[model samples]
Target: MKRNNFHTHVFRCGHAVGDEERMVQAAIENGLVELGFSCHIPMPRYRRHLLKGTIEERSINNIPSFIRKLILGGPNMRMPYSQRHIHLKEVQRVKEKYKDEIQIFQGFEAEYFEDYQDYYQELLDSNTVEYLILGHHFDRSSINERYYGRAILEDKDVLKYASQVVQALETNLYSYVCHPDLFMIGKRTWSPACQEATTQICKKAKELSIPLELNSGGIRRGLREIEGVVNYPYPYDEFWKIASEIGNDVVLGIDAHFPNNFKEENYQNLELFAKRFSLHVIENFTFRKGKSNK
Candidate 1:
């Protein structure tokens, strides 16, 4: 398969490491024909309150005061508006600079908040982003209410998360869904509820012709072994099995938080997972000029 990775991040997201240029170089070194920088977009400033007194606040407060201070002071969260503009400009420069060597794209891994739909539309109107991928890390439109992947554990929450993903896909605003099985992150056992929720998501994706990403970052994080059994939230076998049965389009996402994450081993693992599920993984995604790449 020709090497291509569309889901990538940079230091502006606060959690990811390395500069954008280094990420591009790493892609080239890995012999990738195409690389897309889909960094986390900065949330609107007015919505800062959504994160302030929520679960994130409690989590931050629990951290030792000094470590909390370090996290609060850093740009490791979402990029501020001004910083996002500067980052986009830099990405444009890099894309043009490496035009001949590789196909570089600028995009954002956007979270779907119903209340923030207008905010996303404004971003698109600005023409700062070339593509957007739906990365639903939270359950409710009000993310402060419930975080699906990390915090929510009940099987019922799985349906909520899957429904949110389906809604995001219905918007027709995203090129693809990233980590569609992320809702199963903390889920340990496969149950009837889980199966039903996953089926709903898979059917919707198949009907919409949306490609679900088999994220490799989950592998890099290592498998979560609960009660002597290993579980992967993304690239989750059970979910992919259903997706394959439904014949939904599948794509491999590096979800690269660092330059080194674009490794041959990760690619191999993704391929193996796809093969295990009998999935036909899409190798290269076409980049749409002024819309989400499909």
Candidate 2:
């Protein structure tokens, strides 16, 4: 079986630790055959569009997001657009420097933003990015109350998450779905809406053959009591059970925000997640190449 992790991040994405070459060195140390640098993508006009979101209506929810964005000069959430070229240049240099040691890929863990549709296509068309995975972190906008990970008391937001994800998968742009169970972050237990959301996503991904990721980032949060159940914030047991029954193709994503995240324990946990859910996890998928020519 090929050892590869299609999710990773570096200092450019304010929230994570380490740099490009440091991350590459970590992957090589961990024996990763392929390491994908999927830092949060920079939107061309971020603050402009972010202001266009419903942030004003939800002033309180916008504070923390802005804290990182403002204090970090907006590098807190994602790399600023101006830094894109420099970031890619350093990544290209590291990629060339260690080509023989390990395979490195430049990818982005992106959200589905209709405003940036043309930009996403341009990145792919120009070969600026090798592939993209739908992280499904927010609603139409990124930094507002619409963020799916913002609140997780019930299925209301998750249902919306399902709707947006379905639309994204239909575009045939993303290579895989990351953390398909992200919306279950704080839910106490399963519900009908959870079933509806999971089923909707699994059916579409199965039809499109886009593998669903069993991400380990959520595993770092450790287990918690969901009513009587104990499990990670995501890669939720109930969610994966539904996925297992549906027989959707599954893949493991390290969601490596830190360099040390490329270790053996994380991989073991991912496999343990599959075993716990009876998931037939696959190790590879067709890396997407821009929009479908058809």
TM-score of 2: 0.94
Question: Residue-wise lDDT of candidate 2 within 1-294, one digit each (tens)?
Answer: 567898998888888999999999999998898888888998877776677674544553656767656444456778877778888998899999999998888888889888877787888878899888999887777665666766555678778789889988887778999998888875557889989999999999998888999999999888888567887888788888889988999999999988899899999988988988888788777877546442
Give me the runs in candidate 2 sitting further than 4 Å from their true place. 55-73
Model 1 TM-score is 0.87
Error of 2 at 136 (Å): 0.9
**What are the lDDT figures for the candidates, one per model?**
0.76, 0.83
Question: Against the hidden reference, what TM-scores do the models get?
Answer: 0.87, 0.94
Return the clash pairs for model 1, or none: 14-76
Off by over 4 Å in 1: 46-75, 141-145, 286-294
